[model samples]
Target: MAERYAISSGSAYEEKYGYARAVVDGDRVHVSGTTGFDYATMTISDDVAEQAEQCLRTIDAALTEAGGSIADVVRVRYLLPDGADFEACAPVLSRWFGAVRPAATMMVVGLLDPRMKIEIEAEARLTR
Candidate 1:
């Protein structure tokens, strides 16, 4: 069996919700739906664009710990309560994903917190 490892962002929700921020199985890394909340400060920005940037930052850290980077991302999912906010985040998304060109999906859905404007999840396969 392949080794399974879990990574934490030190978000209280990870402990309260009983889910890891990311999990690595073999060479694959699965990142959870990450919000804008900075784990270190436990603070979030009201602007959707700022939130989107923060989400990617968190995901990148998790991927790096799993021996990978954003370029290794093969799949990505974007969730937001307001579809309109998606446009504001497009540039931030493109900055991180443009060259990598991962399979992607976007959905408008309610989040656990009303303050959360967006959530992102990603899957990556280690190439090195």
Candidate 2:
């Protein structure tokens, strides 16, 4: 079996929910569903585009802590409560993923919090 470990972002939810921000097994890192909340302040934006930006930022930090970067992301999933909200965030998503161009999927689903406009989950293979 490959050696594995967990990485945390110090989000309050981690302790309350008992889940790591990311898990590294061998050279693969799986990041959990990350939202747009500014973990430090626990605030979220109402705008979907702005929220998408924060989601990538959070995922990037987790990937970095796992010894990889967003460019290493191989798969990504975008979750939103409204399908119409996705277009407004397309440019933001392209900005973060244009070059890496990971396999992707987008789905409309109700999130845990109504304030959350977007949630992103990613998987990466370390090249570092």
Candidate 3:
């Protein structure tokens, strides 16, 4: 069986929840749902576009640690607290993913944290 590995960057969630930010098994890397908070301050921005940018930054770090890159991403799932914010945030997301164009889904849902406007999760493959 292929070995499994977990990666983290000492974020509070990993320390408090006892979970790695991401796990890699075989060729697949599964990243946890990431919010738009700056870890240094544990603060989330109110602007939807800024929040989306923060989420993608975190995802990028997680992917890099898992030996993958954004280009290797095969899927992305976005959760937005308000449906109306989709248009406001879509351009930001598209700018980040313009070149890669991975499979993606976006949905409006009630977030666990009321202050959070967006959350992002991703899956990537490490090619041989």
Give the top-scoring candidate (TM-score): 1
TM-score of each: 0.98, 0.97, 0.90
Question: For residues 1-128, what per-residue lDDT tens digits would candidate 1 score against the true structure?
Answer: 98799999999999999999999999999999999999899999999999999999999999998889999999999999999999999999999999999999999999999999999999999988
The TM-score that candidate 3 achieves is 0.90
Candidate 1 — which residues are off by over 4 angstroms? none
Give lDDT per model, in order: 0.97, 0.94, 0.86
Choose the strongest candidate by lDDT: 1
Kindly report which residue stretches of model 2 are placed more than 4 angstroms away from their true locations once superposed. Answer: none
Candidate 3 per-residue C-alpha lDDT over 57-98 given as tens digits, one digit per residue, 9 for 90 to 100 = 888888887777878888999999898888888788888888
lDDT of 2 by residue, 1-128 (tens): 98799998888988899999999999999999999999999999989999999999999999998889999999999999999999999899999999999999999999998999899999999997
Task: Enumerate residue pairs that collide in model 1.
Answer: none
1 against 3, candidate with superior lDDT: 1
Q: Assess candidate 3 and give its lDDT.
A: 0.86
